[model samples]
Target: MTESFPTVPLDGAPGMPLIGFGTWLMSGSECYEAVRTALDAGYRHLDTAAIYRNEPEVGRALRDSGVDRDEVFVTTKLPPPRADQADQVLAGSLDALGVDAVDLWLVHWPPGGARPDVWERFVAAREAGRARAIGVSNYSLEQVDELTGATGVTPQVNQVSWAPPLYDPAVEAGHRDRGVVLEGYSPFKNTDLGDPVLREVADAHGVTPAQVVLRWHVEHGVVVIPKSATPERIRANLAIDGFSLSDDEVARIDGLAEV
Candidate 1:
């Protein structure tokens, strides 16, 4: 069920899959089965976090899916409390995920003054080969700049909440200026699929509103991770490559940001 996907190159690491599967608000057997479903539906990039408390389930699913270890791009985060103890935190994550190294390891959040110190450790983790790439999430542009200034290393990726309605040119510019990839979470959560614009675009493309939104993110050069427990929706989200939205349609959807 593997499908070809565009990859964003890392400065000195492996390329990341553009479309990733997210695991959040899912746990135990539910999380296990959902991970299996996502893998079966052609998703090669998987996003999880220590705070999510489902790494074992996700790890089990990875082993059970029969997908090659190198073929799949796995990303996990370091909890805020362990930000200063990145080595120990990553060791715990590795044990939880049952892997020696993760493709990407991110600092879940910035904890004020300690952020710089934590970021330095994350950089050390990358240098030590515990993570192929290092980055941060829920970080502001200024914070990102500060980290780079303090450590002399820009993050490979900056993950944030993004959707048609949450589009911000400033954020895009910030990432672009520093060669950081913009990864979007909650791609469909904040969006209303029933909105006239989404529905109209979806109808014209003969696809679902969810697909329209996912396609918009893909076309905009943003990496999107959409979480879903439904099997049909998981497959539908990947079918976005079949349709293309015109510039006018992209703008129309962009207008939703102000609505």
Candidate 2:
């Protein structure tokens, strides 16, 4: 099918959209409406998790959106400390989402000392076709390497809390070297929209700070999933294409990084 959303090719699997709708803090009917609004607003990627306790609602939204299943990319995460139960957890996620298989599946966090076993289970689930693409979240550079080393299966993507203060060039570069894509969650860093710097950029681009931040993520080749429940904001978020930031503008935001 012709792609309805801007896509970033996964290292192994098919392409994923540069921006995805996140359902982290939303729940109940709220999540359903938010996700439905997002889909209506042209968002083709949806990020949810088993622990979020809202998969059923999200699934309902997807079904109600009138969009074809093949056109949308649905991503969900495995609950923490469930290395041994990866298969079962994924099964439940699929059942709740009312999908035969997820487009991408992620480990919410590295299982610390249990990472090796957890990774094994993750690989098994992927191999079983329960998850089309498998990756990790909140994993440091060291942990990413460890998982890849243990399983000999590189992650297709690594979702992390990436913002100006927390962006790590070294880690990003390492993942790139290993052919892993970096997906940024919480791309806004809870920054106020009224912030002067972001506002300035927004004004320059005739867009909002949220757009500037999301655009920055795209410019840097990061896949971003930002959560919002407001219809206007959801529409505004997907309207990030068609603008480009200059090298200096990109650098200015990078300088805002806190060590």
Candidate 3:
């Protein structure tokens, strides 16, 4: 079955596939097969991290899948603790992924309570063609301003754990003003799949609660990376293009957020 995947405007960077396959807490052969399956299922964007310790497996799958390198958007992160080794870490990541450069590279987190310096190194990597676009994950507004102030190169993306209860409109708007796309991790909140509001929306649409949450991310204009190892779930996750929620339904899901 051909799936119509959505594309999101990624600031100055190339357009990002709206739904990316996230590889967190998945490793070894399991990671390899899952990635292969996702690609075969038409997932063009893949999200991984240096901390995940499975880039090699993910890389193997990519190579074995025979998909052209440029056709797939591969993203990886650098552990915050390796702030000083940003350049070296990026090289290692490239080696593991068996690629000369990654589509996107991120500083996994704010490091040493100071992110500007780490961000500067990321800027260097971008200049050296180690990564096509550089960004941060789990960063606050202050950190975003600090990095832009120091490097004058605003991040192309800022990934964070954004769901109903934890969604921060101010942060989202701040990044948008700076031309940084918000990539939401853990859109399902790792639980709450059975929440009454989400269940109602899912039943109304005749889809799964997971699809409702992912659609929420898409409507909010945030990029999303939902991880799954099951082939059926992977296919189900990508099946969100046929339906949309009404304004009332969206407000209902937004209202489910706890203050």
Top of the candidates by lDDT = 1
For residues 34-64, what per-residue lDDT tens digits would candidate 3 score against the true structure?
9999998888899999999999998999999
In Å, residue 162's CA in model 1 sits off its true spot by 0.4
Per-residue lDDT value at 87 in model 2 = 82
Alpha-carbon shift of residue 219 in model 3 (angstroms): 0.6
TM-score of every candidate relative to the true structure: 0.96, 0.95, 0.95
Residue 52 lDDT, candidate 1, scale 0-100 = 98
All models: lDDT? 0.88, 0.84, 0.85
Assess candidate 3 and give its TM-score to the true structure: 0.95
**Model 1 per-residue lDDT tens digits across residues 61-104:** 99999987677889999889766677898999999989988989
Error of 1 at 229 (Å): 0.9
RMSD to the true structure for each prediction, in A, is 1.6, 1.5, 2.1
Order by lDDT, highest first:
1, 3, 2
In candidate 1, the residue pairs with backbone N, CA or C atoms under 3 Å apart (3 or more residues apart, or in different chains) clash, namely: none
Of candidate 1, the 10-residue stretch with the lowest lDDT total is: 1-10
